[model samples]
Target: MADQLYLSLWFPNFRFEALPAALVSVLRQFALVSGEKRVTAASVYPISFTESPVYQRIYVNDDRAQSTEDSIIENAVAEATEQLHDDMAYEFEMKWNLWMPEGNDTPISEAALDTLWRPHPSTVKILGFGPHFDQATYEQNGHIRVDFGLDTPWVMDEEQEEVLDEEAQKHVQQNVEMLLAFTLSVEKNCGISSRLLWTESGEPLAEKLIARLQRLN
Candidate 1:
């Protein structure tokens, strides 16, 4: 089974007023690592996830001129965090490419496996949490939480009976390297004091990746 993956980052002596700059740093790091320069969207949720956003902006569109300013990491963070408060959670969405199987329903033979792998764009959410938001979820989820949607690009379908071949293994390894590179870049460039990569099911991603690699071996 594939699970939702998240990277949580904590900063030492962090203050709510510093969130905008921190968010810009994190988003800029992501752009540097993933090569996706624009932030597609941003939203500010008040109090908790249940409440409607107090502020929202979408930069993705056909018109390049309109989104030019707002799509930039610094400007997007500034606009979203303009009304910053302890109970507001600011979220930004960006794209990252990952290797994925083209078709899963139809199983491919060894000879055709290589043709089915390609780089697919995936949505990555970078969220900055205020201290009082969601009853202080930041205490456990960290001041900044990166929601990487699904772990499929890393582990694929673990439940599938089909064993990965050399081509499949190669693609999987590429995805893993991309994930590692992004995480390492965020840790180094974002001035993070601590970080955690975890899954929705409470299972360690490293253990699962090790198991998958062993199978591939």
Candidate 2:
């Protein structure tokens, strides 16, 4: 038998289990929501793990789920498989302590669940690319250089757009902006202990788009 455990995301501040309907709707891609504003993506976090979570349960809905006596590994896959009606892949998010698969023996999917713990393919990847942009500070020279990137593989040319297309180009630009916003929000959450800061765009862009973001901000 293989090991498995529950997988969950913990938001200590909010009493509600952090699962949001919008986030679930975008399960095929990344979804970041701070109050009202939101950002989305395709494959934001990817995980290829040697081991599974402490709990092997995976849920595909907007609601938090638990493992049942009849809920075996095959059943969980059936659950995730049922939700695969859409066009893309998605990672699983578990609220901390609610439910997770446990283990390290073999990848949870193939292994039979002897214990409650088993590997969830989605959990294996979500931790690699955290649900949100987790900020990491790097000190270079005398300044701090904040760095961030998508947790999952950022798909650049899914539809063979590697060639050339106006719509594809615009989509690529929007993707970059989405990633940038994720990085910025995470940086703000870090304990900077500062009252004021300046902002500027490091990349070149059309003047019109730049002005639009500024106006909206």
Candidate 3:
């Protein structure tokens, strides 16, 4: 149902401290290439959006490929670990439907929004939308919090949706959990993870995610 690309890397003599910084630096490269507004690297489930790697499959389509951030990530890994000559980079496998929604709660509507707008999943046009934002979020000792504005991530007020009604707040909370779940799933296989809390002041999850986030192609 879904396609999964698994990459396992072994870097010799790589210190744990250096590994974390290496991942963070490479992630920063991702934000720059994808123009993603925000990301959290400290979560148990890490996720980011650029474009559909499938579009670049070349085995079938290419014209519809908006961009190939997925490939960029792959190449980034090679370059990232290049300094560590002792490390060996090998393994490139793709399985279908790896990121299927299945029983998750991100909602098709919000996902669709991310599909169309937000981070411009099909192209790099998102840069024209506005400045990008990055963040660091963590769950330590069962306590969760986030530091937004990688560059300057503050609450976005498209209109005045700052004070969300109770129902709206609940919806936001749900999607936040859904995002966490989805990101975590990818991280489980990719050796990366992220958890970023998004609180919709008064807007719907679909509106906020689609308008603000960049979905996986």
Please give each candidate's TM-score. 0.87, 0.28, 0.25
State each candidate's clash count. 0, 41, 19
Candidate achieving higher TM-score, 2 or 3: 2
Candidates in order have lDDT scores of: 0.82, 0.28, 0.28
Q: TM-score: which candidate is best?
A: 1
Error of 2 at 170 (Å): 0.3
**Distance from true position, residue 41, model 1, in Å?**
0.4
Candidate 3 local lDDT, 1-217, one digit each (tens): 1111111222334343354344434344335433442321111111212322211122111455565443443353343333332112111211111121223333322233222212112111001000111121111200112111110111224332334333333343443343444334434442334423333232233344445433211
Tens digits of lDDT, candidate 1, 1-217: 5689999999999998999988889888889889998899999999999999988888864565654866888888888887879998999999988776785433322225345677778899999999999999999999999999877778654544256667766877777777888888988888889999999999889676766667666
* Candidate 3 vs. true structure, TM-score: 0.25
lDDT at 28, model 2: 22
CA RMSD per model (angstroms): 3.2, 18.1, 15.3
For residues 106-175, what per-residue lDDT tens digits would candidate 2 score against the true structure? 3223323233432122222232122221221011100111112222111222332334244433433443
Best by lDDT: 1
Residue pairs with backbone overlap in model 1 = none
